[model samples]
Target: MIGLLATVPALIAGIRALRDRVLEVAASGATVVAGVGLLAVVLLVIVPSFEILPKSARDAERYEQQQRLDELDDIDAGFGPGSAEEAGQEMQEYVDDALQLLEVAPRTMRTTTWSKSGTTAAGNTCRAFHERIRLGDQVDRSSSAERLRTAWKAESDHTSFFERNGVLELSVHPAAATISWIRADNQLIVESDCIPYAAP
Candidate 1:
């Protein structure tokens, strides 16, 4: 009977050990199953969903708002920390460009491209080419040198002109130097052709 009692305690210890071993095996299998489930969700669901889901512009709207700021460089042509005096250069270059736009260079003058010499030469050639413009069917050659001097300043000052139409048209500014003109039926002729006609 004492031997039987000792055997019972040993049997109880073995049964407890077996129970612990079974529980450990079950926990390990469950961990593997959960790991597989998580991996399958990532590969099948999460990865495939990338194609269906819409993405962001990464705050592109915010970037566009920043672009409109005055601190940003060259927001547009009107962007300014500019001075009123700089507009004089703008006005100057405007007429220079007009020469090309109107196809009127006749020849670059004895001086710079848009200098007094160039404008005077341009005025002379324009007068020679279109001097036949009729005022009451009367030819007006009031004086040659006076017309030349007047034409010279007209190009600079933006004043009354008829025979100097092409060069004058080019000189007249849209805003700062606006001048009214009486457009003739035949004027604004291309000055390239006028070069040969201009006096030597």
Candidate 2:
């Protein structure tokens, strides 16, 4: 009877150990599954955010904004004329004079592409090239000479005055000092230098 009792207890202990092993395996499996689920959730949330699609979208938006800014700058720089007839007249007058102030007018005009721009000066709204100047039919030579002198001043005063007076708006700088103009036809133009045209 005692041996029988001992055998019963040994059998119970064996069964209990088997049950605990199964429970431990189930717990380890649950832990692994939970960890995998969390990893999947993190990947789903984070991977798309770093993907190329969103980054490219942001880059495209930035490029569009930059283009809009350039267009606005062009508008502000005075590249358009209010009236075609007036633009033509301005171009024609410039052709006749050939910018005597800057002998480079013809050559520079030939070398560089001309484009229309707009600017305001002396409270008058006039359409002209930002980097070029074309005198009105009544433009005084002394006045033009004075303009040249002011531009060639040893100090940077000429550049400041040019902006303040609206003599020439330099949108595009050149290798050498340059003058720009337009003809009555509203054609854009440039001159390398106009100091030679100034009166001695």
Give me the overall lDDT of model 2.
0.41
Q: Write the per-residue lDDT of candidate 2 for residues 1-200, one digit (tens) a residue.
A: 34334444544554555567856555555545555555565566546657877889999888866665554454455544333233443344333444564443443343333434333321222233223343444545445555455544433432321333334332222212333332232222443221111012
Candidate 1 residue runs with Cα over 4 Å from true position? 1-58, 70-200
Which window of 10 residues has the lowest lDDT sum in candidate 2? 191-200
lDDT of each: 0.35, 0.41
C-alpha lDDT (0 to 100) for residue 165 of candidate 1? 39
| Per-model TM-score on C-alpha atoms | 0.20, 0.27
The candidate that achieves the highest lDDT relative to the unseen native structure: 2
Task: After the best TM-score superposition of candidate 2, give how far the Cα of residue 84 lies from its true spot, in angstroms.
Answer: 15
**Model 2 RMSD to the real structure?**
19.1
TM-score of 2: 0.27
- Quality of model 1 by C-alpha lDDT: 0.35
